[model samples]
Each structure stands twice: as C-alpha cells, then as structure tokens.
Target: MSAIKVNQIRAKLRQLFEAHLDLSDIGPTDGERENKILSRCLAALAIYIQTGCTEKEAAESVWDGGDDNGIDAAYFDPSDLRVVLVQSKWINKGAGEPEAKDIGAFTKGVRDIIEQDNTGFRAGLHAKFSDIALRLSSPGTSVHLVLVSTGASVLAKHGTSVLTTLLKDLNGDDPEPIASSEAMGLAEVYSGLANDPLLSNVSVDATMLDWSYVATPFPAYFGVIDGLQLKTWWKTHGKALVASNIRHSLGSTEVNNEIKQTATSTPEKFWYFNNGITLVSNEALKAPVGAASRAAGVFSFRGASIVNGAQTVSSLAKVDDDNRLAEVRVPLRVILLKSAPAGFGDEVTRTNNLQNRVEPRDFVAQDPEQRRLRQEMAIEGVDYQFVRSEDSMATATSCELIEVTTALACAAGEPNLAVQLKTGIGRFFVDLSKPPYKAVFNAGVSGARAFNAVVVHREIERWIDKKKTSMTKKSGPAWGALVHGNRVLSAAVFAKYGSGNLSQAIASFGAAFDPAVIEAHCDIVHAKMAAGIEANYPGKFLAVLFKNPSMSKNVFDLACA
Candidate 1:
C-alpha cells in the first residue's frame, strides 16, 4: 500500500462502516457492541472497496464473527479461478502492525478451507458453502490471502516470512500460479475510494479541428492535448478510462520505463518520440479554441476508453505534479462511435493494441461472436457473459474465455480439443486468428445451449477435482505416478459420454441428467484414464503430451479403450 491516507477519506470510510454495520442484535454492553460493530464493519468495507462486487454483496459476503477462524470475507471469482480470503482489522487506537498470531490464524484458516474442514468458521459461511467448497477444491485454483487494516504500520518481518512459506506451498508444481499476500493499510484504502467522485465530469482544453467529420462508421479527430491536460485527464478519470486496455499500467516496464524517463528528462521531444493516445467514446463534441482550423482542435468526449498509450498516459501523470509538463504537449486521436455496430470498438482496440506489443488475449475481444453470444444468451433469459478482453473478464459480468471455449468445444463433439484448449492455452491461444481458433466459435453451437454446457462442464470439473484431491492425499506418489496425463483426463470422461458424437452429448445437456450419475461416470472415466497413463507414459510425460493437441486425442482414445 502506498502512503496516502487523507483524513477526509478516512472519515468517509468510517461513515460507510457506520451505515452498514448495526450491532443491535449482537452485543448488550457498549464496549462489546463497539467491538462487534468494528469487526463486521471492517469485513464488509474490505470487500466493498477492493472488488467490483456490489455493496449489498459485500455486506452479505462477510463471514467474520464468533468462531470465525480468523477469516473475514471470502470471495470466489469463478471468472478467474481465484479465491480471495480477506482478513480485516479496524485499529483506530494507532496499534502497530497486527501481531504474528493474527497472520498465523489467517494462514490456518486458508489451510482449513483447502482441507475442507470449516468446522470453526463463522456460521454465515454456511450460506455460501457450495460456492466456497467448489472454488477451494477446484483444479488449478489460486489463493489471494489479503489482510486489510486501518493501521499505518506495514506487516512485521516475521509475519511476511510466514505468509511467503504458505504461498509457496499453495502454488506447488503449478506453472501459472498466483499466490500472494497483500497488506492494504489506511493509505491504500483511502486512495482507492476517494478519487471516484471527482471523475464524473471531465473538461478538457483543446481546439476542435475544422476537418473533423463523421466518416461512414464513426467520427474522428486530430488534436494537440497539452501535457498538463493529459495529466488532468488521468487524474480525474484514473484507471477507469483505460479499463478496456489490454493490460493496466504496470509500473516501470521496458516501455513505461522509457515513458517515465522521457516525460521527465526531455518533455519537449515527447511529442515526436511517443505515439499518441487513441480513445473511443460514445460521443465527442468539439470546442472552440482561439480559431478552429482543419489541423488541430479541442474535443470533449463521453464514455471514453484509452485503447492505446495507457503506459505513456499513466507515466506522464506520475511526473506531472512536479510541474514537469509545464511546456509539454502531446498529439492525440479520438474516435467517437455513438451508433457503431457490435464489436467494432473491440476491433479498434485489437488493431491499436497489436502495435503496442500487447498479449494475444487482447485480440479475443475482436471476435464478433462474443457480442452475438451475449445478445443471444440475454434473449434466452440467462445472464451469461462472454468476455474477450482481460479487464472485462476481471471486473465485468463476464465468463472466462477459456471456460466458454472449453464448453463449446466439448459440445461440438471435440472433447479432446476442449481439453487441449483448456490445458494448452498458453501455447496455442495466441493464434486466435487462424483456422482452429476460429472453429471454437464457428462450431454451430447456440449461445443458450453453450451456456448450459458451460454450467455442466464446471460441475464436472469440480467433481473430478474432488477425486484428484482424495486420491493424491491418500497415496501421494502412487497417485501422482498414475495420473501422468491429467490434463486430458476430464475430456476423456466427456468424450466417452459423447461416444464421439458431439450432437448427442449437447442434446443430453439439460436438467434431465442427474448430478450423481455425472459424478459416477466421471469416477469411472478418471480411474481408467489414470491407469492408461500409468501403463503408457509412466514417468514425466506431461511436458510433451500437454504441448500438442494430437497427444490429447491419443490420451482420450486410451481412456476410451
């Protein structure tokens, strides 16, 4: 957490706590009531401030009280396969960092959750038991253990070491694991919530270019935005303005390192050296600046997303408070797409971000099928969201792309392909523009049906993960040796169910199939696959089998045999 606790914002946090936590039913004495209120209030406030989940959800998500086992708030984000365990403290007495015992308690609670022994947890967790159990035991689930305190002190040295060891254990042999400890003190809490009110209305100073016009698809503009103006824009709008960017402003990258260096060292040469920021807005209105000419203009945009130059814009804002941008200016381009067709903004984002060397995941938004799927799912009365970009997937009401892709592939009669896609996304997902990538969307699966399949697919995954957990714990090395081809094992289960016929499996994907039956079938398929892997690729075969698609098909066949 950065050192930025404003007194006014601290008061706001207190006000929020007071409004949400009512201790009328819990404690009789004044001191007891205050303690109860503080505990509950801290839990709710931590969830509300840090996540995009609603305040109502935040309030109900709190699991801190009697027999809490040191857990405050637990949020399971299915979209990202992450389980966030939040521990909160309201230390208004200027107490230093929380004692090591508190950190140890949190770590023990996480271990308990992973082991499925929630006996001492708060009673409120019973209401969210299924969600918590599924996420905690799900395959490849990552943990984010966070401790939010209103005290100014950072974590003690011993507390940090305890958390680091816990993280290492949680990650195990998984390659793409994100396990970490976050200590959000007063400074970060205030900075996060205080800036939202000031960004509602942004007024920029620029000359409207005379030649700006609506060209068939959308309106476009070219202008000079003073460096001071860019700083003001970022300060007011903050990260929200670039929420659709491929990636957020990661501090001091190879590119942003240059941006910070140039913005401060040579502000005059910035315009020539740096490429301009690209923005998409719902509407753009040109304002008169001196005399408007075809060459330059000032424009005010609504509902803006900075699709490019997020790094430069963020870096420039960092150095601007020191009057480094007094004489600096940068060129900017604005595109207004008020009535643009579906997925057009995504296309613009992909095209521009490609130049910035963004990851291939950003290009997922360029597919028009996602928009169509969303529309169709809405019509079917299912609030299923299919997201393409990284930010939308994280913060919006959207499903993970891999989840949808796997579900659809399995439904299209290619369970092996589904398994390959799920396990090998890092190696194969970068080529979404090519044939096999396009086939995931063009498999003739309807949005309503695919959404239903995804639900079933997740349930199946949960069941299989439970089996894996039980087997591994009982005989660690023996089970590990048996499950050499674990990546495609679930797909083999589905492939056997489909009998190499995708249409039949899809048609069977409704409320008719009993969950008990699905779990039973998965058990048989999983066991057979484990044996097949042990007999075939007995020692360390995942590195090669998981690298290519055809290897997954071979495993599926062995499981079927």
Candidate 2:
C-alpha cells in the first residue's frame, strides 16, 4: 500500500513539475540515474511546499549539479528571515530512511553555509551564496532543514541523533533556537501534494461563561470562552474554521508571533490583550450537556465560520502547552444569520476586519490632497483610488495609493526614499504630516506628475522582467543583483531621465510614453548599478546593499552619472 502511494505521489510530482525541470547541465544520464533525477525533483517539490514559492522558483532552487554539496535545494523566506534547506531521497521500494552518512553530509553542508564558505559548491549554489550568507547572518534569521523521502518512515535512530546534535550545537544558548528540522516521509509528501481539502462545514462546541443572548436584530450570543477550545478547533479544522474570513492567517508575522508568545507564556492576560474571535453561523443553540449556570455552559454551533480573529486563533493553536492554553480566555461572539438581511454576513465579515488593524495608507485616504489628486486624475480619464478596499481589484486604467507612493518615491530622485520603500513601504506612510509623506504628496505634486511617474515605473518593471528571462547562465550574478536592486534601479532611471517640468512633459508626452526610451534608460541603469556593485561592494549581498541608504545612494548616483 505504501509503495502504491509513493508511486502515485511520484507521478503527481512529475506532472506538476516536469516542464520546470532542467537537467541539461547534469551530464549524460541513463535509466539507472532515474532515481537521482526524481530525488532532485522531490527536493524541488519540498521547496515549493515548504516556502509557498512558485514551481519555477522551486525548480530553480535546486543546486544538485557538479561539485554539488549534500543540500539539494534551498529557499530564503524574507517574510520571517528563515532559510529552508532540503535533502531528498527517492527509494523505489518505499521502505528505508536516509542513512546516517546522508545526515552527516547534509549537516556538513549546513555548517559550510554557516561558516560562509562556498569554495566547493556547485556553480548555481555559488551564484546565490552571497545573498544566502547575508540572510543567514542576519539576527533572528532561522534555519529549517527538511528531509524528504519516498519511504514509509522517517530517519532511523542514528540519523535522527546526527541531525539533532547539529541543530543543538547551532542553536546553543540562544533563547530562540536558530535551527529546526522536519522529516517528511511518503505519507506526508502525498498529503502535501494532494493539498488537503478544507472542511466545508465546521461545527464547534464551546463552554461560554457569563453568556448572554440578544433577541433583537438577530440571534446573537456573546461570552468568554477558553483558549483551549479555540486551539482544538484550529487543530481539527485548520483553515476551515476561517473559511469565510476576508483573509487567511498570515503566517509567522511579527504581530502573529507576539500573539503566540503571549498565549504560550502569559495566557491569563490574553482576554484583555486580544480583540477576540467572531463567528457567523447558520445556527447556534445552548446545549443541555450539564446543569446550566450563568457562570459556564456548553453551546454548540453548526456551519460556523470565523469572520474575524484568524490570527488570534492561529496563534493559540501554536501554543504547545495545554496548561497555558487552559488558563487563556477569549471573548467570542457568534451571530446567527437565519433571519438576517441578505449580504449582512459579508458586511459583518468586512466591517469586523476593518476595525482590527488600520494600515498607514488607510489614513492617506482621508487627506484632502489625495482627494484633490483623485479628482484631478478623474478629469484625465484615469481612476486614482485613494481609499483602500478589499473588493477593489487592480485594473489597467486604475492606480492605487500604494503604487502611486512607490512611483512618487522613485521620481523624487531621493535614493533614501527608494531605500525606505525597499525596507518597508509602511515607513513612507507612517506619518502623513512628516517629511517623507508630505515630501511626496504635497501641493506641488500634480495628478499628471503622479500618473506619469507610475507609467514609467511600470515600464521599468516590465523591462526588468523581460531582461531577467533573457539572461544567460554566465550573467546569473547580474540577474540576481538586478532583481534584488529593482527599486533602487527604478529610482536611478527616474532621477536620470524623468522630465523636470512634469505638467508640461505630460502635456507633450501624454499617456503614451516611448517604450524605446524607457527600455534604453533601464538598460543603462541596470548596467551601471551592476557594474557599481561588482566594483565597489564585492561579495556583498545585493538585497542587503539595496536596503542600505548609503549604499543605495552611491549606486543610484553612479547609475545616473
């Protein structure tokens, strides 16, 4: 049975990634080497599953070539500052774990990366060495080693010990461990590939203390519930609990991490700190599980969907200590929609999420200057959306506040603004009354100016995408830097070629800017930036360099020159 499942997973993997696999560089191969190729493909699949990167990205992550280290594939997740290293074994019989020697080799490869040594790695790995090294060296950056195999079981005792010892040594006295490992066998691989279907109707049982009901508008219940119950729902149904949410749980974000830490360490204060979970359900009934009391009573919900507090529930689910979870209390509200007006559920979901976290850009929508710009852009037959809405999807004729801010940042000819964008766009929107925000969107800025900058910025992005596709193996380093320094390059192009008289230029150039001119400027800017980095910041990570204001300014200056 296990062999059948393994074969099925193998077939599915090939179907999904066969077009993405490139073995041209791997020397001549025969039937005997089929397992090796499959193993490499499995490594790519592991990357795709673990990192949520695209198939092409996963396939490109493979470094299994000549002079290859034991590491088969790797990905650097910028969101949480973590690196995922994968080693895969394809066993046709579906019976054996990775040998102890394999674990040793994998650990050594990890150590080599930790030591910043890429002397004996493959060309592809060496191409990415600097950026990976920089990411690994960053504080709070963690390493996750994944062992994927088409076997029925995980690593043997000896193999597990070898990997564990390596993680322990690397983690040492750090309060937050720097290294972790997971082994995915045949069953795990199959489940991941299958993309386990979400439960359609989630029924939850809760003990609501100090519960009260509203008889008017609609049937509603509000009370405090144990965090353990919420955790159980998350454990049983996962994303199914929040199927109706406006957004899924954003994994491992700083805010979510804080929530997790608080729940695990200081559960008693969770009720006061959290906004709590809201559920909209088809039906809710007080269960006669035991003698009813106002202090606590069991309630059952049918077709329940979490409309808000997805992050809170997910964080609670991560709490490993049940005792801590038992002490955690959360305010929960369940609204029954049987007699509610049509679309009220959606309105409930939307409004509930809106009041949770207000982004900096949200404040920009209230600015009179932004309103003026929107009206001005409307006169020119373009839609300028100052307000943020979950339902507003991007259209060719429309530009959102975020995109306009980015374009304005580039057009300002300030490398620091571009660096701020690269680091985090929230920095620009932090204070509308401040230098950065006011500097970009004040009275001097006209709708034509903003629109023109956006046009040019988008053109530059398209050119970069095309150039990346056309790059050859020999130009891999240049390609890497170009991608990493895209914002800085855009700033440089605008600084060098953007019109000084914005309103006049728009009147003359109109919406139809010359693609040839834009592409030419992009070519010059990319070449200059690449050359500058190579000459001045040798062995430096392009990502780190682009985020540094001083380095970015110097590179931008060189590019414009």
Best by TM-score: 2
Candidate 1 residue runs with Cα over 4 Å from true position:
1-11, 22-25, 52-55, 76-84, 111-120, 132-143, 172-176, 190-561
What are the candidates' C-alpha RMSDs? 12.2, 9.3
Candidate 2 root-mean-square deviation in Å: 9.3
- lDDT at 141 for candidate 2? 66
Question: Whole-model Cα lDDT per candidate?
Answer: 0.61, 0.78
Residue 254 CA displacement from its true place in model 1, Å: 22
The residue pairs in collision within model 2 are none
Backbone atom clashes (below 3 Å) for every candidate: 7, 0
Q: What is the per-residue lDDT of model 2 for residues 30-82, given as tens digits with 9 covering 90 to 100?
A: 66466767887899888877665677888888877666668888888653357
Could you tell me how far off, in angstroms, the CA of residue 2 lies in candidate 2 after the best superposition?
15
Q: On a 0 to 1 TM-score scale, where does candidate 1 land against the true structure? A: 0.50
